[model samples]
Target: IMHLPFRGRLKLLVASLTAIILLTWLYLLAGNLENGRSLLLSPCLSETPEARVLERVVLESRVREMEEENRQIRLQLNQLQGTVGQPADGGNYGNAAWGASADTGPEDVENTAEERANHTECPRSPTILKCELIHVACVCAGHNASRDVVTLVKSILFHRRNPLHFHFITDAVANQILSSLFQSWMVPSVQVSFYDADELKSEVSWIPNKHYSGIYGLMKLTLTKALPSDLTKVIVLDTDITFATDIAELWAIFRKFTDKQVIGLVENQSDWYLGNLWKNHKPWPALGRGFNTGVILLYLERLRRIGWEQMWRLTAERELMSMLSTSLADQDIFNAFIKQNPVLVHQLPCFWNVQLSDHTRSEQCYTEVSDLKVIHWNSPKKLRVKNKHVEFFRNLYLTFLEYDGNLLRRELFGCPSQATSESVRLQGALEELDEDDQCYDFRRERITVHRVHLYFLQYEYTPAGDDTDVTLVAQLSMDRLQMLEAICKHWEGPISLALYMSDAEAQQFLRYAQASEVLKNRKNVGYHIVYKEGQFYPVNLVRNVALRNANTPYVFLADVDFLPMYGLYDYLRHFLSILQLGCNVTKCYVKKSRVLNTFQKHCMQSSSKLLLTHLYTSLSPCRPRYHVWTKGHAPTNYAKWRTATTPYKVEWEADFEPYVVVKRDCPEYDQRFVGFGWNKVSHIMELDAQEYDLMVLPNAFMIHMPHAPSFDISKFRSSPGYRYCLQTLKEEFHQDLSRKYGAAALKYLTAQRNI
Candidate 1:
């Protein structure tokens, strides 16, 4: 037999009493209890009128009053018995064991309170909190353990006595985790109905527990049909909750709403989140907030009137679970229900189930909510902080909260002293920092340095005997000259082509660059150039221009104000040898220029006079005006060139490995000549990677002259233009040598034939 509680039994009794009273009254009024089928009768019989009619009426009234009193007493007895204990075997009826029935005398009615007090000692039923079902159905899913649900059950039975009966619904069939917990938390008064839905499976079976087979829903439908005619509502809850306190408080919120509305917890509204829900095919009202049925209060009559249970069964059979699974089964159905009929849902504070993240950014995130009746924790994030102190404090707070009563008295400062020893240590450190009036240094406690952080200082020196007025091609702005000229002076390399701004203008550019913020922290290498209109320096022209401005016997095409990192003397010696060598060598060029408005400046190799002569039949002279720079195409077979390198090969991270480059200037000065523009290093790198035999001096790498100063060409022309004189000499030599060698060889051959 399906067991219904006292409420259901009372409903049946009341119906039966009403029916009997009506029939008997009608029969007596019709003067006959039998054969009065045609007319409804009252219990006022004329045949027995002479037989003390007035007395009988008085007796009937007394009997009715007595019956009413008896019913009231029975209700009280049943309530007391239910609170103290569950009915033994078949419900608490039939036997006169626990309490009295209508047949019992007034004595039993008098002792009902005494009986209730006595039964209260039968274990369970500690603090009685009133409860009424709000949501009739809820589903808990996910394959993970649901320990919170077990705790929730314990709180309901032992603490609050709310849900008279609960239907534990899940797609998981007897999940060991949830099953074990349920058994452990089972109490006397609350009945747990478990429905195993192992039979229901779907094709898209990724979801572990699926109720798409309609078995669980059908089972609930059966239960609803067999409901002992008492319960007007049902409630459903998910398993992912921690019930640290009574749930009666949550249920009471729903009870205030009338049966016309289905009440649930409100999910905070945000358009972004709602849009995603709409995409997921969940029924979210376009106009208002959505609800989370984590705890739901449902009205059964409303559902029955709409045939909701049958409709759920139909949808389940039609294989609609896949589309609905995005929001999960229970959520989807609840959302649909709300959309169809707008319901009243309310939101609880986040403390009810606060979602914790990596650092817990919420206000008062670290502070434990003393009034937090439940928490979701979300995931394992709370346990993963590196600060041991924070973790210790968090653990202590959670532990204290897990148990009953306040362990630490609150201070006037709103701080609690009850904490773990580890937490205390951390707190002490924090207090020290606070007292010192300083902020905690997070970096000092957590950072470390290694070998990669080491740096080498490049020292520079120049011999005192060296010439002070030696012309050095330095492309520099005035500020850089200040930083680098002392070293240039020490090296006896006089500034020749100082391509730069005056000190004041350079200072202004420096301030402007700093204010722009892009180049503020970087080294201003000074040779950075931006061409004006009509100033295209086709690589070769720019080099010729810089070289043309020089008046020294030997010029090093250098950048503005860049001091060689170190080993400058050795580099110059090597360079001198290479200059003496004419054209029998190859080298790389390093183009060091910052991004300008759009275009890039050309190379160091562009200015190499010997290389230019060897590669180009026609050469252009550097004009003071209207001349552009050009970089010559790299010579074929140059890729095979090799060089010897220094301890630190200046060409770093190139495709080539470092090899020593013979210092032609220092030893074999007759094998090479000076090259110019910026790409000279590139050529050297190309040859270096190919492992060529031609010596490339890797030591004492050049410190490029940055934007060397412009000269008054008029004054340069007035001086005995050394560059022009050299070009004239080259032209004279080529003409004289070709004539002399060819004519002599022809004359000698003709004489030998005549002989």
Candidate 2:
């Protein structure tokens, strides 16, 4: 700068200084803008080798400082938000700070505190997007509790994938234990809270106490009020239960209930309800009417609509209470309520709540444990002991507690690794027992005739001569000896009689045959006695054995008590001869049959056709009978009988009995069926399964004798063993047929009867 006046010199110096300052500021701003652009382009910072080395050296210290800062910020935030105070009962429902949602408001905060004070617990706010929230409840308060709350919780956690909020209604001691256990476990998405049963008792004080044990029966009644009001549905489980499948599957049952159905439960599998609770109640079976409440899906909204308090009040009403048994207090009341309003109940599959003890007693109804969703240890003995089924479940319970992933997978989802071999052996042994017990005899004992006996006093015999192509097979038991004598004497064709008896009966029959003068003279009659030891009379097996012995192409499966009329054998021989000559007939049955009681000798004396016509006319009020041969004076008119044989099509399930005539090569009778109920039914069902055609004879019939019904037949409905055997045989028949012909076999067997 140039020398000037003092004022001008001062002004120039100030201007120069101000320009320098402004220029410096612009340069710094440009540099900062470039750095910002770089940062935006390169999101991840790149460091030089020296910078990386410096970072590695101070990483731990820097992390500590950052964590401390975060902790201070969280502490400040928590202080501002206010601490979630402990519940009044000293039980923490969940991690409150971590579970509080962003949507939580001041009202929600106040409500949460109030809920804690009221001793009512709520689930944590759902964190995961689209995750389903399921609420489950259970009561554990009794001296007989073999399983602790931990085992029950573990079972639920092991199987469920969706978020679960468990409400454990229990005593104070169990509440503390469960709260601590759940806190220590800290399972994600699974929050549990313990509700004191005392709280439940206080809330439901209006309910009349029927001296009910603890809160076992009453907890379910108060569930609508006890659980958080936000929940719409909850699955109620017994503490004795162990889950085998995802509880979400059970929770989904709420979706299936109709508008009118308030609860979904399984029927009691055993007759315990029928025998003990129902007693003499009509319109209800022992097993089907009552539902087992071990596992129930409660629709809280629907239950509330029905007035939960009203249910409690009904228990106090003597007239209504008397309709139920106090033995199963809540269960009986629920069943009685359902009985009056049947539409309020939806029956779940028995697989959901299988009563192990009940299934064990009736092994026929036993479902394998692997297939079940929940196994209820109803029997106290089962929990305490190490039996075949009980031991495996106990070990599984322990594995769940340990959280042994590998062992739990093997025991829970898969079959128990340890039980595999034992189960296989047990299964094999059971199959062997089933085989041995199914028929008259398991041992293939030789059948031999001790003597040949016959009675031909009222006979007109026309021998078959050289045409010995037809044979009659009849199965005889203790009561049909006279009927057998008449059949053997009257039939003029080849006959094979299978005397199905025990050893003692065979000895008596042999002596009786040897002393008979009529039997020794008849060359056409032959007797084969099969001796066996069994509780049930295997009539079908004997019939099959007798048919197998016949050498003829055509065989007649006749009842030993039925006497073929005069021209039956002649008509059958002609029919078979025609069939053998390409008539395309597989079976033929008599359209008209006569049943002669002990006092009705006139039926046997009259013309078979005339006898049927007279009987049909005499019994005017009764509809004409078909398919079954009953012991009565009922008959079919000759015109109707003749009209019935007018080339009608024979369905697989046609009522025509196999007693008429059939090809020897037809499907043999199933021998697995035991006792008298299914002897004839099984044979007919099999014939139907095989799609064989049966025709009715136009002008022929047989007369059944007047022997008294056996003890097995008369007491069939009253006997348990008999009923069991009947049901077992029916299942076996369906299974055998289905195995061979697929499920369509059942349709074939049940087709409409005609011809």
Candidate 3:
């Protein structure tokens, strides 16, 4: 009905035409819009353009999938961080990326192990790889030396954690046989090289081991021909002996110094040279002084550069001629060298490379060393060898190693695959059960075998006249008897007990004592009737008597003034057990009065009430003395004592009261008691001579009974002026002995009860 105007009349016709065109255009547009909607809704595309659009959609979907995987990995990393308390790569992303590259699988780990086993060396070394190389060399001229050299090598190689190569330069080619036997075993980090006569260059032109002109000639062959010139450094050992401990620690000590080329393990053996020399040209510098050359660290490079080889050759020629004319050998030349070159060497610990002769020929010798690195048996042709005492040498030999046919092999190389060390077995002796024999009841028969046996010898006498106060004396006697009874009742069979009297007037007392069921036929209990013309030191007489009478493994001297308790046995047994375990000596201590006093002050409070109160009052008569005792309080400075336990406690009770005085400078005392007092104290204190196996046990009763007549103090009143003389002796000599000897003298005194 509407007409588009084309200017009035024209509008009518244009309107009609416009209307027709609009209607037609509208219909066509509707059709095209519907087709587009259908194409957008359809799952399948027909045109190339639609397919191209679908490809774009597929690529976007793939990108979203990759993003999801990355998110999962990040979540896993966070979870791992929570568990390990650290980042997966130990921190930063750079390390993590690198770690990812190398982490193939466990199969790769196995392959690497196989490669190592099959002789493939890896170029990529581990960052933590460490090297510990030790070179050992020894000179062997004959017989047992080959065996000893092998043993030392074995000991070192057995302990080595890193690879070690041992080169032995011996005149005896037979050593290669021994070396081959050792090498045949399944051991890592070890190699053996033998330098025989055929390998060496001899200036003298002699057949190596059969007959060297002398010691110098032998040394010359070793220096000039046998040893390698390129050998930079090495530990040189002598033949013979075994090790009691590890040598690696000694080696480490040498390694700590940059200038360790000429160090040697030293012993107190050098000190004995003074007596040996008898002023023979001042004993060869190091000869009577410092290190022993038996065990040495030679810087082969330095040695060669210094012309040591040439020097030795020239010296050998001269010494060989001199020896043929004068009968002296290598020691003289060595002595001269030692004097000339004093600063070239350093002395190591005594335990390393010790000479067996140090324990044998030297006075005050120490037979037991805690750890042995090397052993030098340097005396086949010397005076000590000529004067060899088999018993002494046998004991020394037994002490160093767990003996067997293979002990030589074990000492030098370490135990064979089947051999086990017996240190634990020896230590187990402290226990009351035999590990070897399950059927043996060690508790009943040999219990406390290593415990110290304390003895207190006592004698009784009634003064001739009743002119003096006898109550103190009688009371003292009863107290002594009660203390002895208490100790006997408590310790019983573990300790030895004895009583002696010179006067037959006390025959009834003796008869009753001898008849007493406790004393009759008892192994540890006995009585003696000694008839002496005049008064003598009771302790000295008793000790001499006990040494003769007792057959027990050990004995200690007890004073009559001490009252022993049952706990003493247990304490001492435990203490000695630890010492035996550590291969050390247990020191016996008299429980101190001052320490007990401190216990009474702080511990005796109602809240902390302990047995210290009763122990202090009961054990006071024992007269324990410690340097810690102070006048202010009982010296409670028990910390000064070498306690067996970490948190220490005072054990034995001792009295400050002096024992009987022996007359000094008296021929009888010295002649009768050779090992008593000063001599004994000196020997016990000797750093060299002392046997650490013996220990003083604190647990048993070292009970002192002042009332007991261990000494006939009544004789002091009867003899008048003799009282002052004897009192002076008691105060000066006996007290001094007590202070110096401590409990060691008690062990000897305990012997008196046996007498």
Candidate 4:
């Protein structure tokens, strides 16, 4: 029987005995754990001291080897599972799902998101009337995590057939983005609520888990507490995965769960739990193969009835005595509990998870499955996974990654009484158009006017007033986006950028943003789009849009043409802090806790001046109000400002057009003023009327870079009708301010003849 030398044969025999003894102990450990007894107390080991010592040596050796392997694979495991200890920027975590081609097999599977989302392929059920929601939940953290979450929601929306409710456990940044995103999409049948993960952190903070995802990953275990008590069932998902089929079908499995079965999970498709990855591999014990926690269907009421918290907590405590800290966090504990309480688990079909890890043996799952339901690239390599069929999955995921999120906004099926979606309304109106009309401009005017599509949902949120952060809020046309890099560099703070342009310009700007180094990578910038829907530019409307969306307490409302002097942003924050100025201290809520915000101008005592370039001197000043314009600039008294070390108040002058940092709730610009003349003048006048200090800052500078005139400015100079309308609007504005404040509004200005 021995082909090898005598020593080699002896070594092989020794190794075989070692494997047998290890497996035997493992078998006893698994059985003993099920009976709530440690392997140390097993009768097979005997009550003898020698057997106890042997058992200790074997078990200790196993745990040490496993820990070493875990340390080596922690990073790889985190990426594979779609969760990371640190928040990645735009592209780190892969947001994709494997899409195996359609194979002929048995059909009629059902899954989708219903009840809280607007679905187009509405099932003939009374989902809308009965409000039968397919409630889904996700645990998300980090700044760019929303990118994956967005794709996950898109997949749900893509296959959903009824009303859906989304429950999100998120940090502040994620909550801000998701709340704003869903609000802007305005999907009729969908509703989403956010629970702060930070608030739930204390629930799991006591657990000593060393999983690569850290405590954020443990948030899943606290789902029964984090979610509302009324939420009886929820389909929990990780951010890295996307559903290839209807999620309603997955939700349908909850009805299939037995009274004792509280959690539905897919088995680990890889041979990981079989201890075959390596001879020394001693992963957490699982039944047959382990259970993956990436996608879970929880029967919340059942879990609570079974005292899930106490049961799992006791389980974690017991495992921790020997394992120290879990290697897989929630997944490990879940499997450990399932091992002890087998009846509590309901296994879902492998098609639902479709795990695509490097060591995956999920190919057996592909046999006769009609459609690839949920393709989990549960590997760090993602699209570059070792699988030969990865390209097909890559292409399918890219389709959704580059998808136009705007297209997902469709009319809610089963809600006939509600207003139609833009597509439906536009399609209906287009039928009324002349058959000969093929011109782009004619169709745009008729179709686009029916939809109010100005929104900027692309933003990250940190809770307001977490610090004394100032945001530069500015408005510009798409032509001026090239100036974004310079301004973003010099200003050195977050920004709220609002643009008024055509739809084509918006698309062009998006492409430019993706290609540009600064625009693409920067997470602090928020883009608000207002396409050119009207003839003359609504300059005030654009300004108001930027100001309203600025999350910071202080907003430096400047024209896009101007760049703040370097370090002016930090300087303002410093000056404001010294003066104890708030962003006007408004009350807002963060998970029911109060947050305070302040305005910038409320504390404008920086040791700097609001400096402007010589662009004014270079340009022709042949307008009718030349003296008033020059006099407004002259009021700063630069003669003293040049040597001054502190701020001095400047009496508000008519036509001043001041560029100042103000609070969140600053005066709104007059909507009545369109095109060029008196647009800024009316806003400054309103600020004066409201008594916000117009202080002259020393050493601070606002440089007006040279730029071509806007379309409205060019029109104002040539068209007499445009000039006439401007004059009339100015007259009415002055008259109205005079009526409201009864001449006190004019108190701040040096009165002059009408232009």
Query: For this target, which candidate reaches the highest lDDT against the unseen true structure?
Result: 4
lDDT of 4 by residue, 1-755 (tens): 37899999999999999999977866676445422346545586557897666556656766676679867775564474342112122111111011111221122011111211233344332222333677888988755566567767877887777677889999876776677667656565787889999999988888777776789889999999988998899999988787787787788777655455688888787777778898887777675577888899999998999899999999988987877787778898898888776656777766778788787866655554355788886787777877656776777676666555556667556554234365467668777767664332223342443112323334654754545577888888877878898887787688888887654565577678878887777777887766465466677777777788888877777777766666887788887675554233442221110111111221223223322212222332321124434644555565555566777777766676767777777788886666677777788778777766667666566555656667777887898867775666666677788888876866533363533
lDDT of each: 0.36, 0.56, 0.39, 0.66
Candidate 1 regions exceeding 4 Å error are 1-143, 146-148, 154-164, 170-188, 199-230, 269-272, 276-287, 310-328, 344-371, 377-755
TM-score computed on alpha carbons, candidate 1: 0.28
lDDT of 3 at 48: 68
Task: Specify the poorest-scoring 10-residue window by lDDT in model 2.
Answer: 448-457
Best model number under TM-score: 4
For candidate 3, write residues 469-501 as lDDT tens digits: 111000112224444454455454333333333
Off by over 4 Å in 3: 1-131, 141-143, 148-150, 171-176, 198-201, 204-217, 220-225, 256-287, 314-331, 358-368, 371-373, 379-755
Off by over 4 Å in 4: 1-131, 258-260, 362-364, 367-370, 377-382, 387-389, 402-407, 416-471, 475-482, 493-554, 570-656, 663-665, 669-681, 706-753
For candidate 3, the per-residue lDDT at 40 reads 36
TM-score of each: 0.28, 0.36, 0.31, 0.62
lDDT of 1 by residue, 1-755 (tens): 13888889889889999889866764554443222122332345433564346435545655676679978976875574343222231111111132344344565445544434454324332232343332333333332223234334433443343444566555552343344333322222334455443433332233222444332322333334433335566655544444555566555544434333444443422222255534554432321334444444555565666666565455444334445342333444445444443422323333344333333322232245455555443335544543424454355334433332111112223222234344456456655553332212321121111001000011122333432222444443334534453444334433333232322343354445446433333221122221111111122222333344343434444444343434454445455445445344343222121000001122224333233333323322311111442222112112122122322123222212221222112111110112121223332333333333432333233223335433423323454543343234333433443365554334323422443
Candidate 1 vs 2: which has more lDDT: 2
- Candidate 3, residue 440: the lDDT equals 36
